[model samples]
Target: MPVPSQRYVRNHLLSILSPDDYEAIQSVAEGVALGRRDILIAANKSITHVYFLESGIGSEVAATPEGRRIEVCITGPEGIVGVPLLLDVDRTPHETFVQIEGDAVRVEATAFRRLIEERRLLRGIFAHYAYVAHLQTAGTALSNGSHTLEERLARWLLMCHDRVDGDEFPVTHEFLSTMLGVRRPGVTTAIHSLEGAGMIKARRSHVQVLDRDKLKAAAGDSYGVPETEYRRLLWARR
Candidate 1:
């Protein structure tokens, strides 16, 4: 399989790697396309391969026996999906899936583990990302519990906006409700609220961000800590 060239690698964790380090990993990696609803990691199942997403969005979701699902974290090129591989763990309780269609460069779990073990920088980079994922989870909890529905929606959209390529993206009331752990009607109400405020434009199955700064103001303090920390820790090394 051809490894993505250094100039073409999109995964943030992979792109910032020193050339020699990048080559070390790329030599073992192969690119795979991921589609909407593709299950990347099933709960409690051994993760066989780890993906460094080249483009698109993935979600860390938790579910109940009653079938209620809520997204706890989101990742794109900025993050990696399989962290259990780095922690000496075989599986995780959370299920990860692609929220939007995209592609990734993946390597066997054991191979990745070995590479990171032999290289301290790779290990530290992933560890730092895990910390950032944690902070994102904390932010989600704060948003879900304390913020109003409209504010929560704004925060969620902002996070998605960070992951994709452009201002407009495909989304639906059903998807938003599932990710937000709310009823479809409630999600629709929030969407209208934001749209009316001119922060976004929502149509049948897509949303276009009209004013990101305004959206941030609506999300208040719920959206930036993890992002700021990502810049501080990851970009500093880059």
Candidate 2:
């Protein structure tokens, strides 16, 4: 395969591609815009395509029988949105949605799967990504169970900022409450705490990061280690 443009290679699994492997799959790719709150994949629905986000944030969430939603994981430029394709499954158990409007490169699932079989390096890279996702799930469990609302909110915002490539992104406190598995009031309080500390400036539908170090501190202890490991081990891997 020919080497793809550096831009595509800079996103998620593509970055891990050997030059030759990148060349092989580059031609089939197409880019798409993702709207805010758009459903990328529905729970139990057949996985038709996989997306590599060039911009924006995606949330992987599970809904309970009583209609409660909690974010289990997140995806951005550093990861693909559809994990079921990598796992050789047709449908995902959780729903994936666009958290912030952005664009992505998408390929049909069948093509992706066939391509993976012929590309050893891509397979290894994606396998490592799956492990990272597992780690994220574990981290979320710990954050929800042990961390304070303010800390969890900070961690979530920092993660979003890292993925979206900017300090400001479109997000509502109400939506954040759902992601944090807390009530809207809790989200409001946490937002105020971060804002008071000068870590972020919150508005109607956006929050701009001001002091990233302070935001990281507000995320507390547990969220930091695993997130740091994610950047070091999974994203930094060739």
Candidate 3:
């Protein structure tokens, strides 16, 4: 597969692919436009494709019998949407929905599986991604169970910023309410709390980080490798 210029431009995993492996898988990939609130994977269903985000964000959400849903993780360009495919797990553990409109590279599961079997470098990167995803899942569970809403919000913002590589992005309060599993008013309060603390400035659809260090402290022990792995893997000088 010849590497697409757009793919080689920004994808973390694609950047790490060995020359031949990158070329091998690149041809099978196709780009697609994703809109807000798109359901990429339904809960308990089989995930037949993996999405490599080029410029948007997706959330892994878990829903209960009472219709309560909470976001477990955020995936953007730094990661893929269909996590189970990497581990060869057919059924999805949770629902994946597009949170923002963006572009992504789609690879069918069958083709991706074949690529994984034949490419050692791709296999290793996905393995590391799986471990990091596991760590994120565990950390999110702990954060929800033990942390306050404000703490969780701070942690969520930091994670988003890390993945998007920016402090500001388009995100509405409604989405935050759903992601945090709280009411709109609760999200308002949390934003106000962070603003009052001089940690962030929340506008209509953007929350600017004014004091990242302070926000980091508010997040406490909730931050994990999913937020830091890029630096450790791609930016570190060997």
Best by lDDT: 1
Compose the digit string of candidate 2's lDDT tens values, residues 1-238. 2323856455766766777776666767776888988998889889888888877888999999899999999999888888778888899779999988888878888889998888877787787777788888888999899989998898888888888775788889889889988999989988998899999999899899999998888887756665676677666665
Error of 2 at 142 (Å): 0.8
User: Model 3 — which ten-residue stretch has the worst lDDT?
Assistant: 1-10
* lDDT measured at residue 134 in model 2 versus the true structure, 0 to 100: 82
Clashing pairs in 2: 1-23, 1-24, 2-23
* Model 1 alpha-carbon drift over 4 Å, by segment: none
What TM-score would candidate 3 get against the native?
0.90
Ranking by lDDT: 1, 2, 3
What would the per-residue lDDT of candidate 1 be over residues 46-91, giving only the tens digit for each residue? 9989889988999999999887889999999999989878888979
What does the lDDT read for residue 30 in candidate 3? 79
Clashing pairs in 1: none
Query: Candidate 2: global Cα-lDDT?
Result: 0.83
Better of 1 and 3 by lDDT: 1
Clashing pairs in 3: 1-23, 1-24
